[model samples]
Target: MSDLNTSRRTIVKGAAWAVPAISVAAAAPSLAASPEPTPDIDLSTSTPGAAGVVRQTDTQMNISATTFRNTGTVPAEGLVVTFAVDSGQTIEGIQVFGSDIKNVAQGATTSGYGTNTVTLTLAPGTGLGQVTIAPGSEYTSPVGQDILLGQAGAFNLTVTVQASNATANSVGYMPAPQAIPA
Candidate 1:
């Protein structure tokens, strides 16, 4: 009788562990098959009045009131803006404004003001908030104050926008000859 009772206890212990293992194996497939949501983003600038320029000096200028639009199905969050300029030019300052953006933060600079590329992002924190571009909405930025120290007759500017779940959007702008002073 004693040997029989010990064998019964061993069987009960083994079965208890086996039941949980079987349940976990049954759940694995469903979790692995779930898909990620997609957000499609589009960007564009206003025509005939895209940007306003003010020449601070022969080598310094401020570009303001550049408008942008978002025509996606979902809100675009975690926005990152990249500015590319010609050689001998540098972006000095940038300011972004939108209904969904509570604050703006400067991103990590690889070469500070010396490099031709500058990047900025929506500020992230408890109260600082972030920039979220809602579908069918519009946003504007004073854009940047740039220095054309290269003394080149004309400089090209390109802006690119990116988000956490959406593909990147980009647009190019060249100040009209009449817009810039000689």
Candidate 2:
């Protein structure tokens, strides 16, 4: 019984010393390795009066044309334009604020011939609407406004030139952003 008591006392004393030593070693590494805390970086005022741009409310499609018809009088390449608006606004029709249709050629075939394609890309924003190519007297039939250009990253409109050997051309437009009534 005395021997067991002495053994227990020795074990308790050993453990008491070992506990503090183990704790000191474990904590020492972290305490010595850590450096002073870093100061936080201030991102405020990154751009003073940076609110000068319009807030993007809806997504928009930017239109562009490529490879238009090569009629007898080379019909000029039609222009493609872009417009934007806030969400839920109805797009009645697109207006051509500007245009440049000047291409002259003397060929054997029609004016609006060959496969002319128009491409539209969606710029980063919110809402979207339908796009169509309105018809003209000598132009091909209007491509309907069935094109729901939502967040479709980008879309292409392929126009087969008119069978008419006479001078002809095709241009597409997107509706203007209407003002929301008070």
Candidate 3:
């Protein structure tokens, strides 16, 4: 009986000492990455077709009239704008336009599209090469550029704009809400 008591005391003492030793040992560190900073994207609603940007649609095609600007230090890159039209609707073509509004005209309000713009062409599969917007640069509302929605009932499209750089990446939907309407 005395031997059993002695054994338990020895075991407890050994464990208590081992815990402190293990805890004091050095550990590499935690593996969590810091979040990257990003610029803000603002969107507006453009009625169907405007400025030859989008084609006419059967159902009231509610397009985006919003424009985006890089109010941050970093530029937004690798931007791919995506969306889907209903069965009756058709995506005739896609277009991306950019401009230096402040440079094109003077006294232009803080809102509205920019001039000195160029229609960015898309690359097959990858769509267009990365759309890079430097700080102070901006793009049109990116509305359903040249989209033709034939029939209108409840139309939903997953419009995503993915912006990425060598250091960071971000994804977001267009200003307009999405609904996969049939």
Candidate 4:
């Protein structure tokens, strides 16, 4: 009887250890699987304003171009680029030029004059069909497309680019410590 009891205890202990080992082995395949590649997008913008200043009367700043480059191993799909401005400032107009872009949407504030953010999205398609930017390729906005600003104060301008398959990247332009004066 004592021998039988000892055999049962040994089996129970061995089973307990085997369960954890089996679980670890089961997880090995998933751990060995490769993760999805992330797309690396770079954003570059031409200088804004003259001497980093925009007159309140003019209320306009012409940015030569805003460029997006894909430096990753994967393609950037369903790309959406958003332009935002600081408080006391408004985004008047932003012309986005891209072959894959479907449309541009601008959001209005309570004042109902100009917007604070402009979003650009890609057309409906897949892979190469709706190519936002392929690896090592780049897209640039058209020249003479003025980025209009409003109000009489200093503000910061930020541009964020996001893709369906990759993380987003942002770049900001604040002319001076006080930012671009309007």
Candidate 5:
């Protein structure tokens, strides 16, 4: 009986010391992850702002090829990104940032067939193929002829990016301090 009691006491004392050390070690890695700095990719859509003839409330939006720009740091090999639109909208005409998005190709084909093979498409469930973005570069689509959204949808523009370098280790908009205030 005495031997068992001594063993139990030894285990409890060991745990008391181990618990705090384990906790601190576990917390260290979490402190390292957080708001990874990525370039700001802003999005703009065509919505009839307040300057409307009749304050168009429920009108369809004319999305002329949305653009994804790399205003952040330039990736060495370029960033691989995908662009997508909501279910109610359609994607048409893919082009470079400075160029206008046009579904209709105006150039010759790769096979000497006098046509182009590449195309741009983004629907609710489907996303456009990933494209590389050179540093300080942007990709724009030709004026989407039929991409339309509800009036309310026009008011909000959401941009989601999936990058290995981008981390969500942030509390609020800022990084939490590693050391608690003394």
Candidate 6:
């Protein structure tokens, strides 16, 4: 009778331990395989477009202007402009479009007479090339013009503008916040 009682107690203890162990093991899989979510970032800014130059008259001295804004949380630097210029006309250099309320009719930065002008000479021939993107560096902004040797009809010019530390989007060499001739 004593041996039988001891055997019964052993069976009950074994069952109690086994039940909890099995339950814990079974529950662990659900916790390990659960899915979690990820996070994202936000950026918003504006870029300048290509400057437009049209023959207001039939002289080599045509009118050109480009307007650019930061439209971001910070300031931009080394803005360059690139465009096609006719070799027939003499490119006198770059001048600022001066007029308060809406400046930059001449060029970029520091308004007033003789204050905002850049002298860029053009080469001779039909395809006179110049970079608003400065020499040695890869990008440019703050527009300027190439002095031409002669005149040619509406040449196709491509301008590239960019900024760093804020936002930049480029389709090939051209970056975002762009303007083009109408």
Candidate 3 weakest lDDT stretch, 10 residues: 108-117
Tens-place lDDT per residue, model 3, 1-182, is 67546687798999999988877663323345657655343222212223322224443334545455555556555344455544345443333233332232222212211211122222212223324566666655444333434444555454544444423333333545346343
Model 4, which residues run further than 4 Å from truth?
1-20, 28-36, 39-58, 72-80, 95-113, 120-132, 163-178
> How well is each residue in 57-151 modelled by candidate 2, as lDDT tens digits?
23222222222222222222232223332333322222122211111111111222111222222221122211222222122212112212233
TM-score of 6: 0.30
Measured against the true structure, the TM-scores of the candidates, in listed sequence, are 0.49, 0.19, 0.42, 0.49, 0.27, 0.30
Q: lDDT: which is higher, 4 or 5?
A: 4
Worst 10 residues of 5 by lDDT: 173-182
Tens digits of per-residue lDDT for model 6, 24-102: 9999987796553211111122233334444443433233333334333333333333333322323333433322211
C-alpha lDDT of residue 120 in model 5: 29
**TM-score winner between candidates 4 and 5:** 4
Task: State model 3's lDDT.
Answer: 0.42
Model 5, stretches more than 4 Å misplaced?
1-60, 74-130, 148-182
Q: At residue 33, give the lDDT of candidate 4.
A: 70
Q: Rank the candidates by TM-score, best first.
A: 4, 1, 3, 6, 5, 2
Superposed Cα deviation of residue 107, candidate 5 (Å): 20
Give stretches of model 2 more than 4 Å off: 1-8, 31-45, 48-51, 54-182
lDDT of each: 0.52, 0.28, 0.42, 0.52, 0.34, 0.34
Ten contiguous residues with the weakest lDDT in model 4? 104-113
